[model samples]
Target chain A: MDEPIQNKKVDTPQDNSDVITMRHIAKSFGDNAILKDINMDLHKGENLVILGKSGTGKSVTIKLIVNLLEYDKGELKVFGDEVKDLSEQELKKLRTRVGFLFQSAALYDSMTVRENLEFPLKRILKIKDEKELEDRIKEVLDSVGLPDAIDKMPSELSGGMRKRIGLARTIILKPEIMLYDEPTTGLDPITSKEISELIMSMQEKFKISSIIITHDIACAKITANRMMVMDKGEFVAEGTFEELENSSDDFIKSFFKL
Target chain B: MANAPAASYKGILEEAGNQVLFMFRFFRNIFRFDFEWEEFIRQCYMIGYKSFPLVGITGFIIGFVITLQSEPTMKAFGAESFIPKMVAISLIREICPVVIALICAGKISSGIGAELGSMQVSEQIDAMEVSGANPVQYLVVTRILACIIMIPLLTLMADALGFAGSYLGVNLSNHVSPQLFFSKAFSSVEFGDLLPAFFKTIFFGFAIGFIGCYKGYNSNRGTESVGIAANSAVVNASLWIIVIDGIAVQLTNALGY
Candidate 1:
């Protein structure tokens, strides 16, 4: 929030050590052009929120960095390596360092909350020590304000609880990069604000860089160190929350008016 | 409407191609480390042991009904003593395996289709992938292998129970001893007949698991698609079972069984 907002024409400082960089990235499906020459950079330990209405490629842009969807053209790099060029094994290894929280929280319904937490630990982290596993699960559960939810089933949790658990699961790996797709999309305002603050606090605690894709204005204001507004596959505004709020651009103004 | 037929044909081709590719991917990841032994055994319990009671009942009824219905005809031909042989051959070569598969296709395939379909809709699969997990290994391989192992084992149980039912049916009118019934049952059931019947069910099991996985894994992101996946799983797996049965019969017939 303290980061100085750059003017629309003035470029933000770019360093070679940026965790993720995208230049002139373009992606399309069939005849529909979703992303057109998009450029982005996520500095280490920064929360960069991309705000836009639905179908503007806000989520797709972040997804591209994880190589969930390939950029049709232009350059996209994660940890300075070209995403599309990575081998399958490399891509999988890269994904381990990048945590993605889906909109639904996507908890495995068949498993209890403890099993959900243990899944990535056992599967991805290959953590075998029972004591260490329990300690790590408890650490994340407490961080997300759900210490007692360890033994509960996912179906028993409410929407806000599920989101907290999802965040806990994502941050358990202490991923260098966290990708939140509509983290607060389907929750009450109080819950939404809670999630936004959780994201901010987690960023500070873990020193993780994040790309949060959402149209929730409160979410952007609370979580974003720098914010960008995307429309029709390209960024239209880029700055701090207050900077974008005070801008004269009609589109940017309309978003902040609410 | 001009391209409707072509589009339909294209969709089918694409699906077939994807399913084959899916099967290969399943095969590739199966042998890798993290074999999901716990999940595999759990699936064996669900898909195999849970299927036994139903298969047993169906097998018993098939044995009984066949013995009862064919008894009058065999009596007319003065081949009444061959009733056990008739029931055994039908149960082994045709009835038990095919019926068990159909029953399993209805139960297991639909259940898998719905479970995975709902998971897909909820984005759990993507969550697994994004978290650096092998979804195919954890989900598909365990379920498919469970089916491959379970279906055949269940079919064997069915074969044995069917003979019991046949014996009970035989005693309904005539008092036949257990020794007499079993001897006559195995009279026509040769080593050749048993081999094909035993081996053919592996294919049936594989088809049930594969088709169910294909349908459920690829189902679109909608609640309605869950139903579609389950329905289509049953339909496709049943067809695959019949087609495989036909092929096994042809192979056996060619071998002069």
Candidate 2:
């Protein structure tokens, strides 16, 4: 089988500018291999969408970038530092630079929207001034277009509103990299499109690199600078949305079929 | 067939080992210098303050019923004056702490277990970790420490209410004033009886918090695990309370307390 087009980029000269680099990465839980010798890169200031079926290790790959899950073999580097070699403090510092939006949004349900947003700002950034805390929270909530939701508990918010709040909470610290695990999974198409637009806008506003894992082709078309299609724990095809759409491979064409 | 029992034994040992490691991590996080005082105070309010009414009621019932039932037996033995002493020693040294701890195992342990389990199921704990916040420090240590501080205080309240209920019981049949009843209750009670029982309730508190936090924190990745964690926390904490009670009794006897 021919290599995916994205594998070609993995061979390019190592650049300090690339926010994340994974080479020959493999991971397994017991005998079940979840990722097998996959190579990938996230260049600075680009949205790299990974499209895969459920359980194809899409979530696991993004999890590895932040050291949420360890790779069993090969190398993963974030900001040129090998992920597995980082000390606990260094791992934590790396995590602060990267933001992850989980599939379920994963907001602290016990906390109101304002407290949820305040969590990272207080714990990681250690912002002590009440005035500063209030301002930052208001700013982030306003940017997400849910300024009225500051006092509402997570259970009180609609699904789309919760996702937006989750995004706001992650971006509050102004991270350099964002790993979105299905940012628009369960929402209606209109909300999904809006979230995808928000992802693009956030990229433009923050100038941060992103890796969006999704099966939503419409989302891939709207947000991906480049896209990789995963199959059976490996990258089977990779190109721009238009390039992959025009590819001769039937499996690649299946993703683009309306 | 022989392998089955061996496997079961190995599984239990492995679980015990994991619990020890979890406890060690809890201790390590306690000394990590950035104790979450705000969250600790909040947990104390939730775990300690909110649980007072139930404990108070149970204590009152235990004291009243024990006094009432023991009356006939005491009158038969021609030792009716010993009723207050008997209720006092029994409630303070044995019944109040054990019963109150068991009640907490059902209420606090199960509550913490389910709450944390649901948090785990929803991936909030993961979100905290990825955000570089210590979830153990924020969630586990605060809850356990709150249980430790609050359970003893709750037991103390139970002890007082138990005595009050006993006074009411004593008044129902006879005409002892509050002063006479309390003085009679304390006359036979010594520091030896108080110290060991009071000391054992502390262990009971620790066991309840530790088991609850451990079960909830390590719950598997499913909604079903939430219920399982809660059930397991209550059962294990209840069992630990009994085991600790037995050990305390043996130690007290050996030391001539």
Candidate 3:
């Protein structure tokens, strides 16, 4: 019963406080184009939720921001610096400023949770003192609500616990920006809600910007400050959650009715 | 369907090119500072020390079986006294190094392939990379260097064990003492024989480590690829070991080693 509004151009608010900006980004793997001329920006201290079906390149967008995957065309600038032009050392320094939480949490299986947290601290921060490492680890563990998990292996934890630990590892470096690739995927509803809440708390506590990619409506409702729904390698709609929820376009409204 | 064979050939050529490039990266990373000495030492223990029991057992059995099998032929020619000399020379110049390397190809290469493949499938390598940690320097370099150092030492141990097995085989049929058997065994093994064999094992180690790490590090994103990586690592490493052995033998002969 919604009126046709497909022709309406939802204006994205522009600001100088943007931490990540992708101008006309296009990426392809062979013949299959993942992102075709996509333009977006992640503003400072905002949770930007990208909702899309599987393989619509929502995850790919965040990956491009972190330079996990390179875009074939267009400008990708992080913190006002061009990403593709950075040298290896510069790129590494950039990566340290951005934290990425993969879908599987990607916790090193061979390492204990404490070692997992210690990895970035030791490697990137170069913190050599045992006491400092211990204090930082304790503080991060408390933040993630997993203090007892320090000595435990990743395999011993549940999916939610792994995601928490993964989040802990990401923020342990105190990154300015966070990229969460399907943070609440493959979890029970209760656990997913908890994770979404945790994401909000993390933004509040660390004062970090985030780009969260997910298909979970509940998660999007709880976490997204701004939402972008993508279809066929391009974002079809962009607005705040309430604006999108009541959008006149059927395609945009379809997301909320689920 | 018409281009199937050509496509397959192209794929193989592409694989070869990738492997060469991977080797180049390995050499380049070797000079980088912040070398992972702890991981390298750990890899040495895993790839080298843990392989002792299998290598030792295989070396012993090979020596024992060869002596038993060759005894009747030697007796027919009245060359029974030359048995120790023949076993010593053959085992040192060819048997011990090649056999032990093949064994390690099965053990070490396949292990690395599976481990790394799983790591890839699970995105652990990507995680490490995004964390600003150099995975190649940490994982690949340490493993390859461990293989290079440990394989030679393992071959030396296997040679000693092989000689002991030959001694036992000799005692099973004759009254020869350990002293006389060892004396005859070592008398013909010159530095010329040992050096080429030792050097060839180093190449074998490189092949095993290189192929395994390459297969694993570059595995496709699927659970099935883990098995493929492990299988291909073993098969390719074993093949490269034989090829390198053949080439080394020709080079040694040309140089009169």
Candidate 4:
């Protein structure tokens, strides 16, 4: 029985250190415990994948990190500031630095692709200079390799294209950290790979730290520098892909058996 | 599972309590948080400006038809002078606001519900929160505020259109001049009849927006939940409007208004 990987100690510049850290986190819906005593650290420029079977609270973990779901007990800190205690204005300011790609791509259907991408930029950031806004839109869209999708409605795009557009929207703010919630959940194998590759490429290009929640082993193996498997509301294993492959735990072994 | 009757009754009571709590929280949030002014303006545009054409057209047609249809009956009584006053009081004091609300309950409530339900299904609301935006303030508050501002304006427009329609209706039957008709209408209207009807619409607007947003915001299950949210929003909002209107009428009558 291999022991779980010891939590790594992250070295920070005397000036800057943790981007996000969660301590003793727990959440429940009625009597059902969704997450239990979760502790994790996300450092700068690291891609962390949370691998879990369906209904294992993988998405809940992401939601907790982003303050989407309030935890019953815990301290969640983003940029070394306590998230739960922040004022509304402070929360809005913090959001400018984080980008999230929702599971369904979650594009506003009433708006065009360009408008969807521009929504946060204009509404939240108040970027009124038309040329600069257009340039930013083009840059993000080009980075995701969908430069031509500007005028297209979300319904007009393919699943892969929509995910790419979602990625484009997520990175529009040039966030320091990105959260991807099952980014490839419903796509074909080929499209899923495209999304996985895009996720990796985007992380590398932007030097952005990421937490990706997915059930796709192929995606986890290809993109995660470090991976954690969660089962029944707790993390059972955490290690590099090679280290996890050599793990002897029945749950971990059987997970990758196919 | 075998507890049967007692357990089932308890479950029903629990569901009822939860609904009451939901409504209570929905109302509380409006006053508890500092109102977001920009969002309020945006909502006003959504609820008021966008809805004007539909409410306006409907009001006009209803008024005109009512006058045209009622002329013969009033003529038989030789009380043709009372046509404008009757139409004015009926439409302004009751019919117009309820009718506009029903139409809006269909249009705006369903729209808000479907939009929010899709967001819930797609995790967009979660995305907003994670992005450091308050999904409630950003989405729900703006919409409800828009209703607060827009619904009354719509009702007022409906009242005017109903009067115009009555004017046309009267002309079709008898040659009552516009001045004569309006004078008769004004003579019959008091502050009592006008104020309560107008005031009650604010509650109507709040109900429509609140229900639509609540159903949509809390929707779960999956893709189909959006449709269910939209349907429920319309159904619940229309029901609440009628209920509230009835209460308002009773209260106004009690006060001798």
Q: Tens digit of lDDT per residue, candidate 4, span A90-170?
A: 767777778888888878776799888877787677787999899999998899898999999999999889889988887
True contacts kept of each: 0.87, 0.74, 0.87, 0.61
Compute the lDDT for candidate 4: 0.84
Query: Model 2, range B49-162, lDDT digits (tens) per residue?
Result: 899899999999899999999999999999989999999999989999999999999999999999999999988999999998889999999999999999989998999999
The better-scoring model by DockQ among 1 and 4 is 1
Regions more than 4 Å wrong, model 1: A1-14, B1-3
**What are the runs in model 3 whose C-alpha is more than 4 Å off?**
A1-14
Residue B88: error of model 3 in Å? 1.0
How far residue B54's Cα lies from its native spot in candidate 1, in Å, is: 1.7
- Please, what are the lDDT tens digits per residue for candidate 4 over residues B1-257? 67899899999898568667766765666775445676678678877889889999999998998887888898899988888889999998899989999999999999999989988887778666665545676788778878877898899999998899888888875787888989999899998888999899999999899899888998985889999999999999999999999999899999999
Candidates 1 and 3, the one with greater DockQ: 3
lDDT of each: 0.90, 0.92, 0.92, 0.84
Clashing pairs in model 3, backbone N/Cα/C closer than 3 A: none
In the range B92-131, model 3's lDDT, one tens digit per residue, is 9999999999999999999999999999999999999999
Among the candidates, what TM-score does chain A have in each? 0.93, 0.95, 0.93, 0.92
Model 2, native contacts kept: 0.74
Where is model 2 chain B poorest over a 10-residue stretch in terms of lDDT? B26-35
Tell me the TM-score for chain B of model 2: 0.98
- Residue pairs in candidate 1 whose N, alpha carbon or C atoms collide under 3 angstroms: none
Q: Give TM-score, chain B, model 1.
A: 0.97
Per-prediction DockQ scores? Answer: 0.81, 0.80, 0.84, 0.55
Between prediction 3 and prediction 4, the one with superior TM-score is 3
